[model samples]
Target: MSAVTFVSNPIHEGWTLTHTGGDAPSVVERATVPAQVPGSVPLDLDRAGLLADGPREDGTAADWMAWCEWRYATEFAATPATPGERVDVVFDGLDTVAAVRLNDIEIARTKNMHRSYRFDVRELVQGGANTLTVDFVSALAYARGIDADARHGDVSRAYRGVRKMAWGFGPFGGPPAHTAGIWGGVRIERWRVARLDEVRPLVTLDGDSGRVQVHVRVERASGEPLTVYATVAGAEASAQIPPGEVTGVVTVEAPHVEAWWPHGHGPARLYDLVVDLHSTDERLDTHVRRIGFRSAVLTGAVNVADAGVESPETPQVSPRTEQVSVTVNGRPLDLRVERWMPLDTVLARIAAEDVRARVEEQRDAGVGVLHVDGVGVYESPAFYETCDELGMFVVQDPPFVGDGYRAGAPVQGEAIEETREHVARLAPHPSLLTYGTVEDRAYGSLVSGIIAVLDHDRLTT
Candidate 1:
């Protein structure tokens, strides 16, 4: 793997944010930090003292949500494009939409904030000083042409899906919310041999032992020999890596392990697993994952027509159509809890301590389970970790709203991959009870199949 330069939080690099309202970026100014690459207009406006403090004269509060335009520009010293090495600019996340340019060349365009974007800047960037600019447009206007019907059954879901100003809403608006500007960070991933693309950790629990199936994916930048190394709970395993894109699995085991339990039952125990891409003895890239020893299942009965109950006059199977039960670690659990979601509109703004505080509050108040609408929404790693520590189970999913009403197979496929990613992120936590079913129960079976295809072990409702 090549050298990776993390330009996370561009604010620290003395970058300037210009509200480029016209055709080109006008010389503008704002504070920039290293971890602040995920800068947005609402956040910027609020910080700049431009956003309305309360309801406006027109009875609208968040006018800046659709009114502001942001141009984030930064200069960094970079190694010139090497003849053998490749340089790629990767933005882990952006807002609703953006146009990225390196030097003066247009390198990439962003549409959906949910997906990540990578642009090859091997030719555009040179050694020495470099100029990188991300022009973020108005998300409200850009979302106008968004095919809501093709994605979510309603445009509201599409609009609400994007990270905008939704939390702490009142009157016309309280805080301006728009999925604009760099929401994640701009990363310069430089590598010559290979780069670790993904690490999918599959963990399972048995009678007296806990196991982890580590699946590692690598992207071959050069046809150089490589091996993958994984270390979990002091146990280690290694495998040879092939060219192009390839996946390899390593098994790690711990005998006579104690199971994880929620709240009153017991403590949530977590183990760390570290994976590395290596060349002979040299470590290329490394990532650490957490795993837990516990399993959850949702078992119950579903009422069918019973062959004789189906008639033209009484077409419906009716209210007693299904009975769902919950169990944790093979033991039946009497579940009675209210679902929870943070009140904050801009979740990214919430600090880790704040998240932990909320989770603690919920657990202290006797919330047995946190029905996380979907794994995609309310996506805070701290949120999951806190639940794990507090022993509060989370019923997670892919996307919450407009589930069974999704438009096509592409959506379902996307959902499956996201579920895999989501499960992998939260796999180490013990507070997760079960993956929940889609809200739109009409095509519930199809959605369930999508989730099952990826997360095969966990129970789904």
Candidate 2:
């Protein structure tokens, strides 16, 4: 990577190019710390990084691609005056869609507007000032054209699929035809991560024995043989994890286990789990997770044909498909009532605090399961982590609304990749249960393929 410079204009410093702008005007500030790198340069409302723009006349899909490239190039900052530390570039909204690149290296991307994307930039960034750019693009023309087509309205999936576009929404209205720019924040930060990259410590009861299944994933760059150890509810176990992507399973049986209860009953007792990754005898990373020992399973489908709504003929599936709930410690609890609201509003205004508060509120209300409708945006990693912490179960579905039902080779590939990413992010969470089927459409073998990506070890319906 070449040396990057912060400038008012889109200037070239060595091999790095820098530019910045936002939904509003801002000042030209120096990139004094890592957190200010993304939106470090001052930006305007021009359609530079936008994939497509317009008053709607001659905009094409090609325009959208160009706009996406530009949005990826734009710069953003977490704070103008950032402390020197482990910086995290967090993307609340990249408009309808975008991929974030740091110093010419691709870091993250999101197709749904309702999700928050974050990238760890500690390694990519160095001491002193650095150049950060945000390339935001628009989805106006594609969104509008898809909405207006006669054929687009023919199927249930068509209307449902458009929900993920996340362009036409909010107080400021939708993206302009062909207009694409960074509509969200480019924040850099002094962030924190537990020593482990991935930690999965599960507690379960089988027959008369209580077990804790432990799995840990260390950071690849650590470049050291890790000593994996865990202490759950005061019980400890240790194992040696040699270097190069280690995957080891250690099971601990608790002879006297106290079960976790459902909402409105007894309080859920969370056991303290300490996972440490060590090099030789020195600890390289340590993560602490409050884990609760619980067992849950979806009982049955309620109102599969028609939710509460009544119709004349045999009503097939509507929005309310399953009566989803979880059973904990022999008690059944109805999950939270939620609809798949499009990612438009939330994605338009990306804020970590806002996302955290929303999830916390849901948990406080005793909501354990969130049935996410496919007609809206996908949840972000930050959102999922909050769910994991709050013990919220997520039922995920790939975008499959309208005539655009993805199947066969192309869609299956996409779904497999999506499953890999989703499972990698949320598999450790005890709250996460089922990986739902596609909405309103089904591809015979595709279901098996998707399950194989993540839950291959278990048998399912």
Candidate 3:
């Protein structure tokens, strides 16, 4: 048994709930205390922790619910037989907005509640006397506007019926559980370091010959030159790269190199491409990435009816007729789709346990693409990394939509900067396929102009 603890607050729907199996209700009932503790501040005073004018503690006030604030810390033993070299601290989520301080150093934050968030603090901490502090601010009360109650009575009833019709449970089915708290799994993990910051293996086929480009980026801290090696289809090649830049191009002549096909016809022969970056006699990092020597382009026209698989009854509509789809080389593929809403302030107030379950469910469903919509704010990088390895494509839009009165003028430069920050953080993923223009027509033009000026390698319009 290791010396760590599990602490969480999960609010499902309007109810405060716990995720610890059959013991959750009992645990919450025993943990409620009104007295404030030292170093733990109340998010709101005067009202005595009540949020949105909910029911009072005595249950006399109508619609009473505790303001989503809790100053609590608990510990759990570390799991035995861990997999990595160092322990990594991961926070699955903390509502819509959270400030996480590990041993007094602020480490993470989240703006969207729709996705689970995480942080790996292996380098930030060491053994003995580790302190973790997380402040989760709720967005639930505001999210009430988007909840079903805001709709017409009959429509809301129909929505509930549809949910029961489909999944046997409506959206509003509970007491407020842990709304704004550490709601997901928090753990210390271990993993080995990669020699290179990034490794991209590019394979291109033309008639009879295949071209391979081993593009790599090694960190300056890893002070060493690397001999990069690759093995594919019983063919082998090596190239020497200096410490700073490790870009190399190699050619292979394989008349029978099997090509991959999309969704139909012959099998998608995925050849194993292993890249090893070695320093003199020592192996530094071994990175593996799938390289499809094929071409994929948008096929359909940009029209509403052609939009891929969106629910027809949704209030939102895609303006373009051509819903985005990919065809590898000449074959069309029917890829699964997953949509992402921004982790807004309202969502941050919700429980992280609910968020984690949703993420796992989507992953379990074999969602192939994640369309991060523009309405919500940017999500944590954990979501992106999951999509990258899970074989999911990501279509990211700048987190701005609608035409406010202040359009053409420079209104919120910070918002644009925030969007740019999100793009920079997640753009390196191989799964990221497209960048949607901001909602405003003029803003789209501005974003395109900015990308053209900054990133000249790819075409963006």
**Number of the top candidate by TM-score?**
1
> Could you tell me the lDDT of residue 367 within candidate 3?
55
lDDT of 3 by residue, 197-310 (tens): 455454555643555565555543344566777776667788877655645544444456755443223444455667676666656556554444434443332345544444
Residue-wise C-alpha lDDT for candidate 1, range 1-461, written one tens digit per residue: 45332222232365566666633212223334232555555555455554446324322235444545677888877878666666788875676567888997888766545545677788888878888888877665544444454244333334432333223222123433444666555677776666677777777788758887777777766666778877766678888876554777777787777787778777777778788887654566778756678877654423344532322321211222322345677887654455555545444466789878878887787767666644236356777887777777776644445433334443444444445556656655666655666655544576567556545665444
For 74-138, candidate 2 gives per-residue lDDT tens digits of 33332332343345566544444455667677776554443345577777764455555544433
lDDT of 3: 0.44
In order of lDDT, best first, we have 1, 2, 3
- Model 2 — TM-score against the truth? 0.59
Candidate 2, which ten residues in sequence have the lowest lDDT sum?
A: 1-10
Model 1: what TM-score? 0.78
lDDT at residue 386 of model 1 (Cα atoms)? 79
Any idea how many clashes model 3 has? 42
Off by over 4 Å in 3: 1-96, 104-124, 139-194, 200-214, 220-222, 230-241, 244-256, 299-302, 305-400, 403-434, 440-460
Best by lDDT: 1
Q: TM-score winner between 1 and 3, please give it.
A: 1
Which scores better on lDDT, 2 or 3? 2
lDDT of each prediction vs. the true structure?
0.60, 0.47, 0.44
Give the lDDT of residue 340 in candidate 1. 57
Model 2 lDDT on a 0 to 1 scale:
0.47
